[model samples]
Target: MLLRLPTSVSEAQQCLSEGAIPVGGATLQWAVWQRDGFPEQAMSLREVPEANVLSAEALGAAVPLHRVDDRVPEVLRRAAGGIGTGAVRRSATVGGNIVGSTLRCLLPAAVVLDARAVVLDVEGPFETDLAELTAKRPLLLSLRWRTPQASGYRKLAEAPGGPPPLVVATAVHAPEGARPRLRIAVRDGYEVLAESVECDTGVASVLDALAGTAIGALPAEAREVVREQVTELLARTAA
Candidate 1:
C-alpha cells in the first residue's frame, strides 16, 4: 500500500482527491485492516499542521487523546482520560474516536458539548455539526464548541477491562432566570441511543419521557441500567 504523508491541508486534500483514504492514529484502522486489508493508498493526517491545532475551543482531528488537557471542557478531559490504557490514549486521535464505527467515550462528550466538526473531503473543507458529521465518514479536520457552564460524563462496562456497554454525558446550561437546561447524550458501544436537551423535568420524569425514545431500543434490563446510571449522572451535574 502507498502511504502519503502530507504536511499541509491542501497537500492532504490533493492526496484525498487522488483517492487516498485518510488515516488518523490508525487505531481503528487496525480493525479495518484485519477485516478488509489495507487500502491501496492512505493519507496520514498526523503530519498536517491544520490537523494538530489544540486550544480551549478547538481540537484538531489528529490530536491524541492523552493531549486533551484541562484547557478543554472538563467532560472532554475526563472522557479522554478514560478511553483506554495509557498507550492507547497516547495513540488514539480525537477524530478517530469520534468517527470510528464503534462508539467511544468522546462521542457522548462531544454530543453534550455540542461540538462542531470541520471536515475535508475531495471537494474541499466544510463544517458540520458533530451530530451529523460521523455518518459521512469524511476526513475530520478539527472540532470546536463553546464552553458550557458545567458538564459531566459516566460509563459502565460489563467487565473489569471490557468495552463500555453504556456511556452518558451531561451538560448544564443556565440561562438567566429560567431553569438550567440539561443536555444529555447516551451511547452503547455501537450507536447513540439518545441525545436531547431537557428543562424543568425532574430526573424521574425525564427518564419517563425518554422511555420510548433514547432507551426504547434497549432491552428491559439494559433500560433499567441506563435509567439508573443516567439519573445518577444527571443528579451530579444538576447539583
Candidate 2:
C-alpha cells in the first residue's frame, strides 16, 4: 500500500484528488485491510491540522473518540466514551465511527443532534446532513451542530463486553408557549431510524406516535425494548 500522510486540509484534498482513500485513526480500516488486503493508495488524516479540531460546536474528522470531552453535548460525550474498551476509544476517530457503520454508537446521537458534516469531494468543500454525507462516502472534514435544550442516550448490550443490540438518542427542544419538540434516533443492531414528534400530551403519547414511525421498523421484541428505553430517556431529558 502506498500511504500518504498530509499535514493540511488542502494537501489532503490534493491527495484525495489523486485517488487516495482517506483514513482516520485506521481502526476500522485496519479491520477491512485484514479481511480484504490494503488499498492501492491511502492517505492518513492524523497529521492534518483541520482534522484535529475539537471545540464547543464542532469536531474534526480525525478527533479521537477519547478526546470527546465536556465541550460537546452530554449525549455525544456518553456515546463516545462508551464506544469500546479504553484502548479502542483512544484509537477510534469520530469520522471512522460515522463512516464505518450505521450501528456505531455516535451515529444515532449525530442523527438526533442534527449534526452537519463538512465534506470535501471533487467539487471541494460543502456541508450536508450527517446521513447524507455518510451515503456519499466523501472525505469528512468536520461535524457541527447547535446545542439542544436537552438530550439523552441509551445502549442495550446482550452481555458484558458484547455488542450492543440497541442504541437510542433523544434531543428535546422547547419553544416558548409551544409544545416541546422531541427528536429520536434508534439503531436496532441493523439500521438507524430517526423521527421527530411534538410532545403534546406526555411521553406515552410520543411513544405511541413513534410506534408507527421510526420504532416501527424494528422487530416486535426490539420495538418493546425501544419503547421502554425511549420512555425513560424522554421523561428525563424532555422534562
Candidate 3:
C-alpha cells in the first residue's frame, strides 16, 4: 500500500478528501487490515511536522486552562486488562486515540480529570472539551489535567482466545474541600463512553463502581460470562 504522512490535519484531510485513507497512527489501521481486507493507500499524522504532540513543560503550563493537573497526581500503576497487548499500548498515543475516537482507550481518563483537548488546524489553536472533541472534530492534541489524587483501570476480556467485550477506567481526585471526584469510562457497543460520579469515595471504591458501570452499560447481548471477569480484574486494582 502507498503511504503518505502529512505534517498537519489540513494536509492529512486534503489527502483523505482526495481518496487516501489518512490515519493518525498506523497500528489501528494495521489491526483492521491484518484481519480484514486489503487497504489501498495510507497517510499518517505521526510524521507530519505540525503534529501537536506535547513536551513536559507544555503539559505543566496547561494547568491554568484545565486547573485539574495542579498537583502531582499519582501515575496509574496498572492498566485495565484486555486493552490489546503491550506492543499496542507502547506505540499508541493520546492524540491518536482521541482523534480517531478509538473506544476503550484512555480518553475516559482525560474526561474524568476534566481535561481539555488543544486543537489546531491551518486556522489556529482552539480548546475542546475532551468528551465532545473526539467524537465531533478531528483531534489536534489532548491535554490531561494535572491533579491531586490517584486513578486505576480495569477490563474484562472474552476469553483466552478472544478480545475484550468491555474495558473500564476510574479516576479519583482529591479536590480541596469538595467530595472526591469519581470518573468512569466504559467500552460499550461500538465506542468507548464515560460518566462522572460525585462522592467522597476513594480511588479503589471508584474503580469498583466504574467496573460495574462499565459492564452494566454494555449492551445485554455483550454481557454474560464477562461479569465474573469484571469482578476479578477490578479486584486487582481495588484498594
Candidate 4:
C-alpha cells in the first residue's frame, strides 16, 4: 500500500506520469483497493488548489459532493443532494463520480447542462464533452459550463426513495419564439443522450415525442414509468 499526496498540481502531474493512479476522495478507489489490493502506486489531489475550487464557470475535479450545495444550479444541486449522505459527500468528488462510474448521478446532469471537462495527462489538458467522458474515463482536472435556462432530473428507483435503476434528465435552450433544442439523457447504467431535438415546449407533447426518441432500451412498463417521472421532473424545473 503505497501512496503519494502531492501538494501541487505539477507534482500531481509528475506522479501520474510516473504511473500513479489518481485518487480524489478514494471512494471508488477504496473499493478497488479492497478487492485487488492497492496498486503499486497511487496519488492524491487533496492538496492541490484547484482540486475543490468551485465557481460560476467551473468546478474542480476534486470538489466534494457536499460543497456543491444549493449555490449550484437546480439540476446539479438536486442530483448532488441525492448522493448518499454528508459523510459520503465529504469524500466523493465531482470528477471521481463521473469518470469510470457505473451508475453516475452527474453525467446526465452535466451533459444536459452542456458541460465540458478538462482532462489532464502527461501531455497537457484537453477538453471533452461531459457525457462522452463518462465512458472515456479520462484523468479529469475540472468541469465547466455556461449554464442552461431550463433543466431537470428525476429517478425511479427500485424502491421508495432508494437508488434508482432508471434516471432521466432534460435541458432546453430556447429564446423568444425559436423552437427549443432539447437535450436529454436516460440512464440505465451509463446515460444515453439524445441529439438536441427542436420541438414545441408543451411539456406533455415534448415528453410524448421524447419518450420514444431519446431512450433506446427499456421494456414497455419501464418506459411508462419513466414517462411519469419525467413529467414530474419537468414540473419542478418549470416551477
Best candidate, TM-score: 2
Better of 1 and 4 by TM-score: 4
**lDDT of candidate 1 over 1-239, digit per residue (tens):** 89899998889889988999877788878787879888899888888877998888888989999999999888788889888789998999998888864666688888877788899987888999875787777889998998877777767755766756677677766667767666777776667764564646788777776775756567776677667766776677667
For candidate 1, report its TM-score.
0.82
Alpha carbon lDDT at 137, candidate 4: 81
lDDT of 3 by residue, 1-239 (tens): 77876666577666666566545545565778788965688755565444533432223111111222323232222331233565655555445555554453555445555676666544545776765676666435436465535555555555675544455555555577776655655665446666665535443454456456655556655444333433443344344
RMSD of 2: 2.7
Question: lDDT: which is higher, 2 or 3?
Answer: 2
lDDT tens per residue, model 4, 1-239? 57888877678778888999888788777888898887998877767776666876577887888888655567777777777778998889888888845667787778777788888788766888865576668788888887666777776655655545666677766657776566777766444555456545666776667656646356676577656655665565566
RMSD of each: 3.1, 2.7, 7.7, 3.2
Q: Which candidate model has the greater TM-score, 1 or 2?
A: 2
Q: Which candidate is the best by lDDT?
A: 2
lDDT of 1: 0.79
By TM-score, the better pick of 2 and 3 is 2
Give lDDT tens digits, candidate 2, residues 112-209.
Answer: 88889988876677888876877777788888887877888777765766556677788876767877788888877567888999865787788888
- What is the Cα-based lDDT of residue 146 in candidate 2? 77
Stretches of candidate 4 off by over 4 Å are 160-164, 175-179, 189-195, 199-201, 220-239
Q: What lDDT does candidate 1 reach at residue 186? A: 73
If the candidates were sorted by their lDDT against the true structure, best first, what order would they fall in? 2, 1, 4, 3
